[model samples]
Target: DVKVTQSSRYLVKRTGEKVFLECVQDMDHENMFWYRQDPGLGLRLIYFSYDVKMKEKGDIPEGYSVSREKKERFSLILESASTNQTSMYLCASSSPTLLSNQPQHFGDGTRLSIL
Candidate 1:
């Protein structure tokens, strides 16, 4: 079974603080994604990497960044956390070679609280 591990299940921070959320997948997936979930906004992709060292910014990329130095690891970074940025962040992994209709397997998610 494929498993995705998130470094923190819950986090709290003050405004203007830098936050780092880490994710690691046991499966050797070719694609990894970071998304922020909020009320009414649904799940908005923040960034994704198709391969090692390759990254693509998603819809809401203004307040977030991502890193993919290895095939099984992806990290999301918030340069300066803000109150509005407080939300549940999800990490997912899927194989690019798989069928396009296939759904991505998501991690448990990290709930970030920005005061």
Candidate 2:
């Protein structure tokens, strides 16, 4: 089974504090992504890394960044956590399949609250 592990199931940070969310996948997948899910809004991508050190900013990468120095690990960093950023953060991974229909396997999720 493809497994993805996220560091925290729930997190609370003060505004302006730096926050780090760690994710690790054991499926040897080449693509990993970070997303934030909100009530009215669906899953919105933050960042994605195709290779160990190759990353692309997604639609809402303004306040976030990513790092992937190892094949099994990916990290999301919030320069300054804000209350607006409070939401469920999900880490997902998928193999480098040629098909675009490849679904991303997600971690349980980390619910973050910036006070």
lDDT (0 to 1) per candidate:
0.92, 0.94
Query: Candidate 2: deviation at residue 68, Å?
Result: 0.5
lDDT of 1 by residue, 21-89 (tens): 999999899989999999998999999988999999899999888888999999999999999999999
Of the candidates shown, which would achieve the greatest lDDT relative to the real structure? 2
The reply for model 1, stretches above 4 Å from the true place, is none
In model 1, what is the error at residue 45, expressed in angstroms?
0.6
Give the number of the best model, judged by TM-score: 2
* Model 1 CA lDDT for position 26: 93
In candidate 1, the residue pairs with backbone N, CA or C atoms under 3 Å apart (3 or more residues apart, or in different chains) clash, namely none
RMSD of 1: 1.3
Count backbone clashes in candidate 1: 0
